[model samples]
Target chain A: MRNMIVASTSTLYGGGYLEYLTPFLSKRLKAASIKELLFIPFARPGGISHDDYTSKVRAVFQTMHVNVKGIHEFEDPIKAIQDAQGIFTGGGNTFQLIKMLHDLQLVEPLRKVIYQGVFYLGTSAGSNICGLNIRTTNDMPVVQPSSFKATGALAYNINPHYQDPIEGDQHMGETREQRINEFHIYNHIPVIGLREGSFIDVQGTTEILKGTLKARLFQAGKAPMEIEPETDFATLNLNH
Target chain B: MRNMIVASTSTLYGGGYLEYLTPFLSKRLKAASIKELLFIPFARPGGISHDDYTSKVRAVFQTMHVNVKGIHEFEDPIKAIQDAQGIFTGGGNTFQLIKMLHDLQLVEPLRKVIYQGVFYLGTSAGSNICGLNIRTTNDMPVVQPSSFKATGALAYNINPHYQDPIEGDQHMGETREQRINEFHIYNHIPVIGLREGSFIDVQGTTEILKGTLKARLFQAGKAPMEIEPETDFATLNLNH
Candidate 1:
């Protein structure tokens, strides 16, 4: 089956962008395993141009002189994705990313690419779309949607950069945990609270956590559990 | 004129259980000369019975020997609200509060009470429904509704407990401001980021800021502004 490596952030710079799959990306690229990198730039900040937003990936690929293309430029993106060697979706607004994907009917094709084991890598919004719904998202409902459904890549939703409630403040706002719990009241999907500098590496069905802190797993009506790196997440039995 | 005070917290205790409403609710209740406090227990935590929730509120009121009534038992809540000396809404799940209000057709009646100068008080979810839409709420979209509209009590939306993004996290989640900004793009309503310990005191035609920090205002296609507590919120034209 096609493998998916979903990260909270890109691990290129000192930025603790959830340093997952750096070794994998490097090894895969060095061995000439993938002929090209198809960059999905829909999550670009403020929906900027693909060239401007995908520059970081382009720069990284330039070091290896690997072929790269931003699928946003294509008039027929579904076919473009179908013909791609591998896919990497950068982070930005998940709502915008999903909006564009649904608008262009690329969700199914992208899903097919992942299921085909065509080397799929996702960051932030990219990672969020891999889940059942954007309910775990820290993003605001900036736009209305036909639905909150996503790719259903995982049984649990993803809350990237999950932070506990601040210790001392008078704000009456609900904490991230509280918000996610509310999401559970109406949703059966479990949630994965991925902090900064953490990620999930899925190689053929095996998910390896990579980061300093353990990821928090939240199932409906159950207390969250912290899982360290090397923990096999697939065995969580999140479906129950 | 109906005096509406959307508090940040309850004033029953030392105000530590809830911390945001010191100035807003405390000052308004004092000014309204409200010795009697009628509590609305529909948003009780743990889904407690209306009688149980009401008894707890009455118990709390007994300490001060202040008259307290649970509006949940009233067949004509609107009439009860119209005749009440003061109505105080404690906070819980905003979805629950909204659902009950809509089911009971009390939104407009509550609005009417506020207009009648009944000295209305609310915290968290209670204050959230006071806006035109709960889009600015910190609550998760636990369930979808036919619409995202609310009471339209204020000219703008309220994002209580606004916090700045962490300085050093590689997590790719959107910040609180970014989320509300997204809401602005999809909806035209102005959003006010009311930090903890901050609130607006609505007395008759005057809505004054009564808190320690400046409230962040977000509008579509415009830069957000942080208005201080002393700013004349009533005079600010938000017609656009």
Candidate 2:
């Protein structure tokens, strides 16, 4: 079975990094019998180095009795993913992550291992790759990737850290909703706007919403609506 | 003379399209003795069609006694830029605009004409092209251009619709400043954050801030600071 926890963010405001996710992680990691994970730190939030980011993630997973290893630690990244008991892609700039993935020629190999039922955890930019493409990401294009194509881990796309337009807001920049509407003009993939603390719990062909908050769903030629917690996203007809 | 008005936005809040720019347009269009201008509506704001978007801009330019013709109306787009007495690129999605520019093989041609002393008016996405690239745009990657490369009419980049972090805001999405800072991690190009109504008035090599507001300037490894209105941007030492 495909077991995954694609979260919107690694940290919640006013909470320690991955603190809010402890309960879920403990249960999921134990269920999968995964005591170690291969971490992809290529996203490099705030330009953090791979070793430093790996250490940071190590500190958190250590609290859960899980060992974490950065992919950069291995001489061959493809081999690292193949040998890992589980995989976790952390949050950061999506462009940077995808660029490094493509540069290392790791996209196909990583996708292959994930489908073989290796446990996977993705937060923020990590969650974005679980979708069809990174086109819907809220992050800036600080770096250009080989393509916007992301891992087809899920049938639809993900817009993490999704925000609603503020009432009486005057900023003329297109709001997240308007941007998604424009995406529909050229694409048909449904997009899930996962608010902070929200995530999709994926197992095999089933994907369910978690973290209590209602998630917003946007598909081409249709009005956006809220998907309550525990709703199966597959029922949204997110198929291409 | 590289006469140009690279504006932050096409319309100010609570104002009609291009209404707030009439005073500047009246003087500039008259000074150039230009009665007709070529419009590139490829940006296609709100997914607006070239014909409809052209009509909207034409109505505004008519009020200034200048006729507006969309590049789409021409069988030969490169020739349109070469033959035009002046040029105006309306505001819209920067990715959409630049993608179309590259797709039509118009970047170098437009750049050549602009440097050849053709008066140019660029609002929002239009203004962004005058910069080095579209890395700093606030628009989503609703579309991916062949490349992020822009016309380099200016030494730096432009972050149109620049916004500051709201006090007491709890959203964890990176602020405008933070995003630019991350950009500096991989890029050294200085970026000008043009607030609504702010613009750069370029004459030959002289680029001065206009629209009665202080613009924010971000440079690699330097603290962001405000540039007062009437200040020339060249003094910012924006060399790559």
Candidate 3:
């Protein structure tokens, strides 16, 4: 299997949430001699249409000399992925993404594509689907999903947009750390707090952290730790 | 005209992000002689049906020997609110509530009800509608509304479920205070951080502070200050 890349942000040209990957993504696809890339924009932000947002992503792929297509354009996205060379799912609201995934029954196809060695990449909500469930997501549960299930693309849950706590505030609401901890209380799955610039590059079954910042890992009844990018995170042997 | 009562929590029953308010709500409603209460449970946490959540609020009113009707029960909620004696919007999610209010054209009706002597009581998302916009709300923007407009019942915004800042956490996301500050940057509305067990009781044109604890008030380009519930907040000068 050639493997997949699950990123916390897009490898876009401008200052995107995942601007760090702009060069890396282009270099990898070119070196791999990849001709076409599939894009999934199901995690539509605020329940808005996918066309406008995906167009921006398509433009990014065009710059890389790679053919790009938004999966929503296909009547049978499952079959489209089955016959695709590579895939990329952009980020947005996790709730909306999961909702559309469930509604369209694309979660299973996505899982298949990753396992079939189709070279997949997911950013933000795309990265979130790499987990067993979307419960660890930082996105608010604005709309209830048909299911909290995801593609199980990774062994651990992901808390994207991971942020450091602020000082001298007494608002008493749950912090992002607290929110992730709540997820741990219910699921024993290890959580990877992927900072804005972080991503996990997967080759076959081996998951490699690819970024400068350290990703925080958390499991049930355990303290969180920071591990540098390029670390063999999949070897942690901390499966739930 | 009768004033408004914005609460921090809903049922005083089982729910996440809960705040206690039975003693506070009852005292103010009785003092205002608010007998008929219109219940709006449109936020519907967990995607529970609106009818089921509305019934629970109705049960609360029944226990208090007050006549209650769910706004959903009305053929035209806008007209119903116009003729209703009082209004009580229960909390769930702010985004959903604001979207529904905008979709049904009930925002103006709600504003008129509060202005035309109908006592208004909102808890959580319910309380959020009292502001000029839902910008300072804690709920996730699951769905986008036609506009960010709200009832403008209060001169300032309310950040309920306010928590103190967590110490020694490395999560680098924007804190609730920071998010509210961002809202102020784009707009000039002030925000009031009302913690659990805290509330605001307005009668006539005067908005008096209630509850046992002090609420934090923040204005654009100004440091936040703790104001006791008993302190006449008339300096805000919203009432005319």
Candidate 4:
């Protein structure tokens, strides 16, 4: 059994950091009895320091009386994950995050604890790492990771911060849908385009879509479909 | 001596494929006395076959009375580049293009021919490979190449299809400028943000900006500057 929140964004447009997620997370924290969490700040949004990223998250959790600690602060990171009751991976560059995770040889350790039923929260780049691989990410490859393989905590991949094509948009760059379509050529794994302000609330095997916005579901050799907010992803049978 | 057109895109918005570039290229072909050329259609847009992509390019070049041969048609791809007096690399997916060029071990041969005074034209993903590396490309990493390295025919990297931030964009995804800022933190290489319709025309050592719009020049630890249409990129001193 797994309990997790795979969020599309850490901060909504014009919203304070973790402001939109606090109420929902507070309810989850109480339900799971999770008073503290180990934060993975390797992504470092805007190239911010690990300490700064952790402090930002800590400040938000403080409002809920839940403690947050950076994984870097620990002498033994693998032990930190093993002993933690909860975890949250913040947003930033996925390549940077994956490089560090592989460099420290923490992929297996992190995946092991997640399966052991640790309450987990992943936002943006954080949500990306919980996929089968990070090939669907929208971020620029600023650094090269050892491989594109990621923790298979989820059956499929997540395309976080997914935006629809703007009407009359003249930009020649590939649209989000087009990029994902190109990805389908190389990979058959189902990809969920998680729009900002929405998330997948995983309780046991049922992955329910949360928030009012409609999420896009893209699969190989199939037309992209609009999925309703209350839909349970488990019903889709993504596994081949 | 080097002669090349590193174009931002193969197809201009609301225009036919290679239509906007035809006149510019027709004159160059005549001046260089190049009646025939080799085409590199490896970056198949929308996953088209290499032969199909070459057909599209061949039809366009046929309008100029310039015979076109795809590198795939030749038994020895390296010899094709060596014998060709002119070359044109069509645009599509940068990662796919880089992987094929590297897979065939043709990076060095292609770069050598460019400097050997071949009249060359590159658009979109084609233009991206002329840079120091592929890190600044806007294309999706659908397929992982062996490395992020590119031909390095040009000293600086190219950010093709560069778009300006839409006023009041509600989406929270990183802007083009913001993404480049993150790239600056990890790399000091100067990046030229080539907007649609803009290209750098390299004649010998002087890479002069062409087209009407101004290009965005990004240097690590410095402000992004707007370069005029006639400005010579060789004056930037990018080698450092």
Using Cα atoms, each model's DockQ against the true complex is 0.34, 0.77, 0.09, 0.76
Q: Backbone clashes in each candidate structure, one number apiece?
A: 7, 0, 19, 0
- Expressed as tens digits, the lDDT of each residue in B1-240 for candidate 1 is 748766554532335443444434455666777777778876654445678877866765554445788887777887787788888777766656676777777788887778777887777677887888776766665554444567777777777667777688543556787787667655788877776666677877787777677888887888988798877677888644
- Over 4 Å off in model 3, which ranges? A11-18, A46-48, B1-240
lDDT of 3 by residue, A1-240 (tens): 647777766532236544577688888787678889877887765344578767877777777788888888898978888888888877766766887888988899888878877788788778888888887766644345667788887777777777666575444444566656655544678888887778888887688888788988877888888888888886888858
lDDT of 2 by residue, B21-54 (tens): 8898789999999999999998888889999999
Order by TM-score, highest first: 2, 4, 1, 3
Of 1 and 4, the candidate ranking higher by lDDT: 4
What are the fnat scores of the candidates, in the order listed? Answer: 0.40, 0.64, 0.08, 0.62
- B144-225, model 3: which lDDT tens digit per residue? 4667678888777788876556566444444556555545544577788887767787776677778788888877778778
Q: Which digits, one per residue and each the tens of the lDDT, describe model 1 over residues A86-149?
A: 8888887676778788888888888877787777788878889888777677665455555667
Identify the runs in model 1 with alpha carbons over 4 angstroms from their true place: A11-21, A29-32, A46-51, A64-68, A103-105, A164-172, B9-14, B17-89, B93-119, B164-174, B178-188, B219-224
Q: lDDT per prediction?
A: 0.72, 0.90, 0.73, 0.91
How would you order the candidates by DockQ, starting with the best? Answer: 2, 4, 1, 3
Docking class of 2: medium
Rate residue B3 of model 3 by lDDT: 73
State the fnat of model 3. Answer: 0.08
Q: What lDDT is reached at residue A204 by model 1?
A: 69
Residue A219 lDDT in candidate 1: 86
Candidate 4 TM-score, true structure as reference: 0.97
Error of 2 at B1 (Å): 2.3
Question: Which has the greatest DockQ?
Answer: 2
TM-score of chain A of 4: 0.98
